[model samples]
Target: MPESNNCCEAQGLDAITAKSHMDESIKPTEPSLIQQVIDNPTGDGITDTNLRVPEGCPRIDPCPAKAAIQTQECETEKGDGDNIALERARNAPPGPLGPVPTGHGENVPLEYWTPLGDLTGTRPAVENFSLSRFSPNEWNEHNKKLSAACHDGIQVATTAGFNALCSISRAYAEADRNQMDNNIRLSTRAGTIHRWTVELERMIADIIEEIDLVQEVRRRTMRVKSVLQVVENIDKDMMRIRCFRMDNDLVRDQVSEEVTKELSLCEEIRDVYIRLLDQIKMQIEELITAKRRVEFDWSEKKEAYEIETESRGLGSQSDTILWKAGSTRIPPDQSSPSGYEYSTKQVLAEGYTAKQRSSTLRVNVDAMIEKAVKDLRDQADRVDLTLTQQIQLQEQALRRLEAELYKDLQQLSDTETLIDEMHDASKKLDGAMKCAQTRLDKRLLRHGVENCRDVPQFGLIEEVKSLSESVSATLGQLKRAENSTSSLIQSRRDIEKEMVVKRPVILTVPYYVCDRRSYKSNAQLEIQSP
Candidate 1:
């Protein structure tokens, strides 16, 4: 077996040498183990042994002679027992523990094996053992690294979640704040509206109050006007009465006329004059009462105003009182004795003096009597002057009354004619009133009011003036109130607008991120649960 192996080695070397020379010009091609085995089966039992050859060789195509010889030789060698040896070598258990079956051993080059030893058993158990054995620990370390990475991812995810939550919360807060701001604005508007409304109401109330006061003042003014009108009418009637009184001859002539209409008219005029006088007297009394009341009120107001003005240092000097008789003085009286009284006084003095002694008497009786006379004359002249002044005043008053009486008489005649016409008109008016009253009564009866004729006839001119004045004053007051109300409303609108137009601002807000890729990259975990 050793000899056969040696001969195979020698033959392999020769074939290598021949092939090397023959392939010098051709590209060298390495053979696989299977191909080497098929080409040189008889040369070596191990097909992967390196074939040796000489350095130089001729390219000779040896014919069938060398091939037949080599074939016979190979046949004889196989018959000798090489087939059984090759079979035993192929089937033999790998030596010792044998070559570990490395999964890629078939891909190893057969040329890499040696022919001297059983390299099949001697080859490395695994030619290229993977680093997989150490991989478990590496994988564990990798897993730990991965776990750390996953932890970081989870932290990132948590951070992203927190940031997202913060953004959402901020948005929600902003929304809430906006809503709150809106609500506050609305509330503020409502408050402003309410305040304006209240102010308007108060203004309206003030206007109403002012209107009421003005209306009341106007009503009193109307009453005063009516009273004044009545007074004027009374004055006219008094003048008519005076004129009638003055024209006695004319009245008498008219009274004696055949028609008797003037007489009847004069009677009616007299009666109307009397009624008018009474009415005028009553109206005058009322006016006087009213004037007295007004005067009293004015006096009170004036007094109060004066006191206030004085306190305020606004008083007038014209209010001071003065007297006209400040310098008048009366002198002492000097008088003279009568003649018989003087003689008696002298006899008494002589008797008294005869008893005492014979003495001459010194007397100033003449001067005393003269002074008395002068004093008496001055007093008489002063009395005469006073009496004369009083008489002049009386004469002036009487003359004025006489003139007034003459004017009154003249007017009285004219008024008598007017009165006649008025009486005739009154008769016609009475007829009309009766007719109207009858008609009204019929209508009133239909409306269930009985005895409608009991309704009094209204005085025309008096009521007409009173009513007209009342209506006029009332309308004036209404106009003033309307103006005041309009002004108040405009003021309220301005106030409301000002209130609504003023508000405060907000600051310091955050922004949010909404990119999916950034969220995923930063996050360790998926948002959707695995």
Candidate 2:
């Protein structure tokens, strides 16, 4: 062999020897990266160096066909080296790798991996190895891109969340507004109900008062009717007695001294009867007048009572009516003339002139005189008898009249007593009404006149107070019920909002092993691994 050739061969063998020694060193230490990553995956110094070749590797000696042989060997070795690196990477735990050199172990560049383990030990070499190198500037640039993407995603999610929250808030606000409106409606309804109730109560009270007044009026009328009936009965009895007396005196006659004396007695009796009849009639008239007066007074009082009751909204059913009858003396009628019949002897004794008598007797002498006198006497006696009988009947009628008069007087006396009693009763009633009015006034003064001012002469204020209290209590209860109902409705709405409406959201990425040929074929690659 030539010296130069030998020298070249020796140099080539030396290179080979150095590469072999380097390969041996790398082969033994290569597994250390995997072990180190596995033991402490998140350790600060741990990296992807375990998948990369070491600092030294075996090389070939030079030959006459060294170029071709070297090329073939290089191609085979490169293929084998890539396979070994891929295998190592597949088995190696994931971490940031150091820089990779271009030619051999020195060409591997540094790379980065996230905390989440993303490597299969058999990962292919990146086609853009320079692009894959883990320079601080590049890493920062990648982090910025990732941060931007994450920020965009976060912004989108936040926008969506904000819109959802706004929608929910709007719904809640609308619901609250609706609830407020409902409450307002309920309050209005309650007010209306209270007003209606108060009106109804007032109407009812008015009706009751009117009914009571009617009843009171009815009672007063009945009382007055009874008193008037008594007066009518007394009047009828007086008329009957008068008629009987007049008829009895119309059918009697006689004339002797005894008859004349009896006639005188009858006349006296007639006078007494006439006087008695007059007294009875007078008494009747007086009683009627007094009763009318009492009725009139009662009517006036009733009117006053009604006025007061109406004005005060009070009932006058308990008021009373009182009446009485009275009597007066009756004067005799003096327009009609009266006369007495006398006997012949009685007439002569009255001193008629003798010439007149002689002339009166000359027509028939003694017989004629006797006949004329006797006839006159007979006529006179008949007249006397008639008069006497009339008088006697009159006397009996008079006695009956006197009895009627006495009865009438007694009735009048009783009526007077009744009148007195009625007057007393009227006074008492007046006093009571006055007292009631006074009490009412006092009550009004104490409680204020707003309620009672409309009443003209109202009676008792206690009654009004009681009625008002009842109405107020009822109104209060109605208000309470309305409030309770409103509250219940509000609570129901709140429950619905809380329990039936309003829910959280979750995102994922997957790990993939890339094919080196596929990665190398394109400048940019999109892997669809789901």
Candidate 3:
């Protein structure tokens, strides 16, 4: 505990807090006229060469800009610092926690520990202890109090102390486990730093509170209500645990540095995340647009196809019966020609007969419409399949992102695993289609319709082109993310290796004061005699 306390004090996290505050208070220096014009153009044909500039040089028309060399501009959208953040985030970790808030410089507030209440025993004062302070009667009284309190009042403290230790230990362990477990999560939208902050802070706060509680018992001022008061003071307690105490400061800083490295990686991954997310969204929209085009256009195609089917007298040829209205003819049920069932020779012969005909027969509208419908349906199916596949991929990427690439970004095996998981979303889409078909089939029967197959009208040439373009864009975005993620993962590994410090385990607190005292009754007396 003392060692931990000493490290915290020496590390001076308060100094970090003070320095950040000072940095925030300073104003940005305005760029010169030449520099402003040079930095103003984003190469999008947009330029701002205004010579008259105000202090800090507010963004001018057709140009979005921040001061080029400001330390505070590290996270600016187009700043070199942000460009460098992709690589240099871990080089200079932020103080307290989180990214620097825009126009604000508040560090993470420290959290406190609360002790359990109604402790009904006294702790023998150990301050300035000497032989004179422990005469025979006083020593006996203290011995009894230590023994009685050890069993009685100290049970709560012991349990509380160990509980805090176990809690913080598990909290730390969980953080490590999560880093591994979250590898899959990093690939998807569900990935976040919020979980890291929440768990890390709780563990650190509990450790600080445990330390404070130990200090209290050692000083012989342990009281349930006082402990509650300390814990209840949110701001003060938070400061005590998070920012002020030396022990608290060191552990927080050490853990914060490691976690900060992780956060930096997450930010880099987020760069690819934004691009990938945007690309995926565009792809999904294109697919959805293609699907809707099919839904509306199919009805018209179906009508034309059925008309042509009837014109060719295919009613008698189909598996299901389809009769035209006002035709009083009751067509006789025709069986297959004798001995031709299950015989491929007969079918081949029929095709040869048609081919061998001397006359050049005209191509029928029936065949033409059928071919068009078939092609349309094929394109629709392709759109649906590709759309589903892209969505699954996006979700998987977010999953891996949330899990963190550090855990799951292995060379080839992980890629295969992701590809293997690709068929699930399509299956779900198929089940939905089946349900729709069931309902549609009933509606058709009620309306006196029969043997009409679903088809698409116009071939979705424009939509297909659009969809293809979106898929290509999405692929490019994903490739970039994957490539960047690979490098970021390696960087994270390096940071952890450099900054990680193994935390010591905290066991239950010592109970009886005499358990730590000398057993010889005359030892104190003899020392005093000297």
Candidate 4:
């Protein structure tokens, strides 16, 4: 068998030599190839070649051809015998600390499966299982080396695992802290936005209330204006009546004069009402503008509240929480925090100012309305009182004139009767004179001495003269009585004409002014409270 092995080895060597020479002859010769191999012995550089031998270097140890041939020849020559030998080698017991392998083996605990005891300085009972050829010291040293390597590997793995756990735990803790901080910030921001929303709501309410009040004041102004206009018209009518009086009757009487003054007062009141109405309208406009601003601000606050609430709802792990494009960048027209606060403050301030002004305007309007009504009422009362007094005086004068007229009429009748009686007496006297004259004429025919100065003729002449003077006195008295009657009639007519001019004024003032007052009171009641 040894001889056959030697023969196989020689044949394998010769075959390798011949094959190598043949490959060398077939390939191209390059002088730099040797230098390339020398520079990169493992061919692990830029080149793809593996380890190479120089031209004159010895052949590689454990030649592949020699081993192959040896293995094949041995198998051909003794197949069953080689199998028995291999099985026997496998069944052999290992040494104290396990088998000392010379090649790569299974990665398992060979010492645990085989032996874990000290080496004995004794031979094995079976020659095939003997470990006499292997030095115990060397096997122990190998076992110790392998155990140390495994322990070192385990220690390294454990340390790396612990460090990885600590690093991961720290990362989780940092993420939790970050999330907590973000939540706190969101909560604070939402709270601030909510507060702003509440403030806006308050401002809006104030503006709305102001607007309502302004509207109410406007209505009141209109009502007051209507009342003033009515009063003014009545005064104008009274003045017109006075103006249309007859030229002689257009005297500046107390009633007419007072009517003119009342008209002027009415006109002044009307002008005041007009001014107040204008002011009310302007105030309404301001209130409306302020309300609009408050509403706009309230809308902004509402939107901000929603946005903040939504933002607060987002979480790190939420699917909806995503990266927004350019989210970190500010808009061009975006206001800063201070500017935003200032703008909000300005809106609130304007609304507050409008509310204050509205309140003040309302107060002024109320005061003006009260004053105007009071003034007009007072003036009307004064005029009514003066007219009543004047009417009473005129009435008294008419009564006196009537009484005087009656006396004058009676005196006139008595004077007329006396004049008639005096006329009759004159007639009788004329008859007596005629008869006496006839007697005297007859006597004169008898004797001129009988017509001479007799006592009877003298008495007849004196009686005729007395009767003539009484008739003339009666005529004078009758003329004076008729003149007095004419004067009394003229005074009564004047008093009646003056009463005609004044009676309508007294009627108009109290009734119309009272109606106006009632209307104003109703209007005030109808107005809504702010």
Q: Find the candidate with the highest TM-score and give its number.
A: 4
| lDDT order of candidates, top first | 4, 2, 1, 3
> Candidates' TM-scores?
0.19, 0.20, 0.15, 0.58
Model 4 regions lying over 4 Å from their true place: 1-172, 253-272, 314-326, 330-337, 374-382, 389-393, 427-454, 457-530
Summarize candidate 4's per-residue lDDT along 1-530 as a digit string, tens digits.
33322322333334345545535632345425434432332333423243244455343222123234245345534643434434454465543223332111111122211110111212212235442232344467557768988898888889888988998898888888887888788788778778877998888877777777778778767766675566666666656655664534456777667667767876787788688888878887887888788788878878887887887787777888876898889889998879888998898898888889889988987887777667666777676676677656655655665566566556656755665675566566667657666665665575656567677667655654564555456555556655654665565566556556545544554455445434543344234212
A best-first ranking of the candidates according to their TM-score comes to: 4, 2, 1, 3
Structure candidate 4, residue pairs in collision: none
Candidate 1 lDDT tens digits, 343-453: 434533433333222111001222322332333234323433443453354356445545554555455545545555544554555555566556555555554464344
Error of 4 at 274 (Å): 3.7
Show the lowest summed lDDT stretch of 10 residues, model 1: 503-512
lDDT of 1: 0.38
Q: Which lDDT values do the candidates have, in the order given?
A: 0.38, 0.39, 0.36, 0.59
lDDT of 2: 0.39
Candidate 3 lDDT over 244-271, as tens digits, reads 2233213443333432343343344334
Off by over 4 Å in 1: 1-160, 181-189, 246-530
Candidate 2: segments with Cα more than 4 A from true spot: 1-82, 85-153, 168-176, 225-530
Question: What TM-score does structure 4 among the candidates reach?
Answer: 0.58
Cα error, residue 120 of model 3, in Å, equals: 99
